[model samples]
Target: MKIIAMSDSHGDRETVKTVSNLSGNAFFHCGDSELSFDDPLLEKFHTVRGNCDSDHRFPSNVLVEIGDKKVLAVHGHEHDVKRSMMMLYYTAKEQGANIVLFGHSHLYGAEVEDGILFLNPGSTRLPRGGNEATFAVIEWDKTLRISFQNLNGEVIDSLEIKNFTKEH
Candidate 1:
């Protein structure tokens, strides 16, 4: 399975559309879209509510199943991601998720700890910490291959997980 993840668009509909159009079997928007829940462009994504999103219709978190993996998606505000990922990690672990997706600080990063993958796709409209506008693609076969890419699909960083079995 291939999954495209993005977040923190901050009302830039065009960028959201661009990322959503990229090649992937599943799409996720971590939040801060600042768009209505009924927006047509958002229809393709499994989205969460950002602090900037005033619409109560969007959920604060979402759980998605892909292949044999369970992915937990959130905007990260409730867990205080700007401070630390500890809370998010524990929450995902408790939920039986193998992967945790979140966005709050507008910075792109990915890491694996205790057999779980944590990813932040960054801000496609407003990047921070010297990072460019970015998104992430996760390809799962025998391994989990994660690539952080620029708007033009150029890779900025990549990670590979060779031991991500379902038992983990």
Candidate 2:
């Protein structure tokens, strides 16, 4: 399965729409979109509410099941992700999720620990810790591949997971 993950767009509707068109089996928005809950572009994204999000209609968390992968998506603010991921990791473990998607620090990164993949796609509007606005694309079959792409769809970074795919 393939997945597209992004976060902290901060209301750049055009950028969101552009990323939404990328090919993937599933799509996720890790919050801080700064868009209304009823926004048309959000229809195709499995989204969580961010601290900046004033929409009560948005859910605080989202669980996505793709193939054998159980994904837990959150905005990360509620779990104080900018400081640490311990609490969020515990939450994902409790939920039996093998993949965790989040954003809040506006930083782009990915890591695996205890057999779980954690990813943050950074902000596609207002970015931090990097030069350009970015998002992520994940492709999985027997293995998992992640590509961090700039707004213009140029790959800036990439990663592959082999050992972690047993449960994915």
Candidate 3:
């Protein structure tokens, strides 16, 4: 299975659409989607409310079960992501997820800890500090692997999550 993940669009529909069309796979908007609840995409998409998305009627996070994988998605702002990963880490475990996707830092982050995978797809609209407008794709198979891409669909980074589960 493949999941296209992105966050912090902050109302930039064009940027979101560009990346959205990059994959024919499932899509997850971590938060800051900044779109309306009735957005056509949300009907079949997994999304959460961001700090700016408060105007919309959606939760700040969501748990999705896809292809035997429990995935947690959040905006990250509430978790104080910049200071540390403690809050986000516990939340993922509490959610019983093997993978967690989040946004708010507008910076890409990924790691594997104690059988959990954490990922962040930086802002597609306004990236920080020389960061390119980016998004991510998690290709889940026997091993969950990640590929980070720029708006041009060029992969700028990659990772293989470790210790996230018993070999399946």
Name the top lDDT candidate.
1
* lDDT string, candidate 3, 1-168, tens digits: 788899988888887778666654678888887889887755556888888885667888889887778889988889999888999999987888888999888999788877788899888988986899899989876667898899888999998754344432
- The best candidate in terms of TM-score: 1
Residue 30: error of model 2 in Å? 0.6
- TM-scores, all candidates, are 0.97, 0.96, 0.91
Where does model 2 exceed 4 Å of error?
none
Estimate candidate 1's alpha-carbon lDDT, on a 0 to 1 scale: 0.92
Instruction: State the lDDT of candidate 1 residue by residue for 1-168, as single tens digits.
Output: 899999999999999999878877889999999999999999889999999999989999999998899999999999999998899989998999988999999999898888889999989999999999999999887798999999999999998889778875
Better of 1 and 3 by lDDT: 1
RMSD in order of candidates: 0.8, 1.1, 1.9
| Candidate 3 displacement at residue 20 in angstroms | 2.3
lDDT for residue 32 in candidate 1, whole number 0-100: 93
What are the per-residue Cα lDDT tens digits for candidate 2 across 1-168? 889999999988998999998888899999989999999999899999999999989999999788789989999999999898999999999999988999998989999888888999988988886458999998877778999999889999999987556564
Q: Candidate 3: misplaced stretches above 4 Å?
A: 41-43, 162-168
Between candidates 1 and 3, which one is better according to TM-score? 1
